[model samples]
Target: MFIDGRGHITLANRMCDDIFQADTSEWLEHLYYDCIHDHNFVLFIQYVFLTETHAHEQLYFDDGWSVKHYEAYGTPVTNSKSQLHGVVVVLHDITGVKRLEEIRKDFVANVSHELKTPVTSLKGFAETLLNESMENQDVQRQFLEIIWKESDRLQDLVGDLLELSRIETHNFQLNLQPIDLSKIGAETERLLRKKADDKSLQFNVSSEGNKEMIGDAARIKQILLNLLTNAIAYTGEGGEVELNIYEEAEFIVCRVSDTGIGIEKQDLPRVFERFYRVDKARSRDLGGTGLGLAIVKHLLEAHEGTIEAKSKPNVGTMFTICFPKEWSGW
Candidate 1:
């Protein structure tokens, strides 16, 4: 955009329409202050005109529904006399870059916090045992148990972080192949049934329709394990957990449901976000790294599949995942 010496918008480009969400053509001949409402942008232009030099700023424009980030550069237009004629401004969209930056920062912070918790516990307990040399064997054993548990939790957290990182990489690909959902469901049931039994929860798995599909068998099992484990962890004694495998149209569907502490309406959408827990304290107590659902979502995306989560607080939660019956690696 070009602002004249009188502060009027003398020229504007098509991109200005998109960046400012207004008709740039209509802005021509109008005063910059009248056309551009963003105070920071106005200030940036004014600074360039006042200093008769180049300036740049990162600005954000909010349009009620969403916010957009922009890198704006303003430079004074002048002739050989070095007298400023006007100010020319340009805006470059950087919303995606800004979002990635925010995500990276959040991820780093979360990883740091998660790692610190277990390390702190392990260090404190180990230090106490080393410094005190308690004569009571039970107290020593208790401290050792805590140290061991924290170490195990730390290992799990690291493993999950690595897995999530691998899945999120640009070059990541699924080991796609022909697989059977029913067999996978049966296997997962066998592996986790003991856990459910420990809580006296009624666990069941039923299959119908055609369960054969093309996917990464290991990842499919991982997805099931994550969902089933979460269901079991959140459910109480005498609660029920069910895994139903069937087909819908050209997709094979697996629905895992449990009478667990369900998520709130506002939190359901973010259940798949990394390190997000509906019950943070209880999830930590249950030895969850909070990356299961995030991994599940990424794995599903790799397979060109989808997962939907529905829940009613204090009633139950259900996850329905669908995989294409056939895949050509496209």
Candidate 2:
């Protein structure tokens, strides 16, 4: 659209009409203020003139069908006499790029936070042992033990974070092979049985129709471990955690259900977000880095799968994953 320095719409190209889904000629000669009713946007335009600089922003249209991510440049046009004419504003679409940038920034921030917590604790405990080596043998031994536990926690956190990054970024090549889903679930249960027992929780894994799916066994096991660990962490002692596997219409389905501290309605949406925890204090106390659910979300997505969560306060939470049947052969 062509507008004068006074912020009026003088002319609009056919492409602009198509992009906005607006009728031609009707929108012509309309003041820009009439089209943009958002107070913030009006202020943005006012700021442009007040500051005399290029400004860029995103605005959602009235119809809600599109979001306009535009960078507008206001340059004073000059006539033959070197006099200032009017500012010409150009708009570029960058909605997709903006979304990608936001995702990348969030991913980086989450990874950094997850890595920093365990590393910081490990470093502090290790330094404590070094500083008080001979003060008291018993105290020194306790500090050393703390340092050892912290180190192990740090190692697990780092390993899981790396695996998540690799899977999410597609940096690691998968050795695709056919495998039995039941067997995989069983193996996961066997590996985590001791931990589940230590917590006095009941772990149950069952398959519907004894189905088989194709994928990397190790990666699948990693997914199970992450989910189970998360469920167990949130669940109280004597709670039941169940892993159910089945075949859907054209997908393989796996659901992990736990009688745990159920997520609040508000927090359910953010559970998959990296470094997001409904109960931050409890999560830290339970040795959770807050990257487990995020890793599960990414790894499942990498396999062309989808994951969803449902929960109710004081009831429980269930995480369901659906993998398309096409991957059964891949």
Candidate 3:
């Protein structure tokens, strides 16, 4: 803020001080635009003075070191005599929020594309079946089967989407109990054994400690199933898939690793996002709902746990789930 007519600083907030990286005494006598790098800010100040009205605008500036965006709002100050005084300016930081909004929009578009493909396929096959005669059973049966499979895929996708929403909103309550992480890992391995066998992959599970925790046993099982199934899905014949359970600090850590087609560096961070696929065509062909990792992420959060991935291209990916042991009430 500066004096109304003389353009001399009357007061400046801490934020403005930080922006200019100077003390109030050093900058008090300076014009409003004296410390601003952008010429537009100077023009904006002049316009506000001319109109004698409050104004709000976005300003971009650089200090020869860093660039920043500021949402600036200036309100006219007046005394009891109705004489114009200095303007009060407020700056808000919105850069992070803007970036997140962009990400959310991208996620929505991706999900729409993911849902559209299967729905279109299902609709087309159903229409084909309806247009054909039942007497020519083979063709009718083929189309019907395709329609049925696509319908089931759609149902699974919808269910996962709903689960993701519930988990995010904390609507899914945990039926917490004392559960052994090793046992859960073993059960998941057994359940996923068929899948591994189908691909001629080797499945293994190991534990280094008690591997026990208090958590929603069902949700814990779901988390294991998703990770193990993901491993089986990506691993090739003769490859090895391993589940390692241990206690790390105050958390129960379970790591599922596979010798499969590893994810690229750029894709690792986004793998937990809904409908995010490294290979869209292949993911569809494999009947992936594209919500598996997303669901896993939400489940971990609901459990007050965390999950992370470490991978290298053409090598493999390791997903680690860490559950807070203190949360285990059982």
- List the candidate 1 regions with Cα displacement exceeding 4 Å: 5-8, 17-39, 61-67, 80-83
Clashes of 3: 1
lDDT of 1 at 273: 92
Tell me the tens digit of each residue's lDDT in model 2 across 29-123: 67767874556556666666556555666654444765656554444455788554444555566667877988899878877776677678778
Poorest 10 consecutive residues by lDDT, candidate 3: 1-10
**Best-fitting candidate, measured by TM-score?**
1
Alpha-carbon error at 134 in model 2, in Å? 3.7
Question: What's the lDDT of the predicted structure labeled candidate 1?
Answer: 0.91
- Superposition TM-score, candidate 1 onto the true structure: 0.87
What would the per-residue lDDT of candidate 3 be over residues 155-267, giving only the tens digit for each residue? Answer: 88878877777776734687887888888877887788888988888888899987777788778888889888888888778898999999977888999999998999999
True-vs-predicted CA distance for residue 330, candidate 1, Å: 2.1
lDDT of each: 0.91, 0.76, 0.80
Q: For candidate 3, what is the TM-score? A: 0.77
For candidate 3, the per-residue lDDT at 166 reads 76
Can you list the residue pairs that collide in candidate 1? none
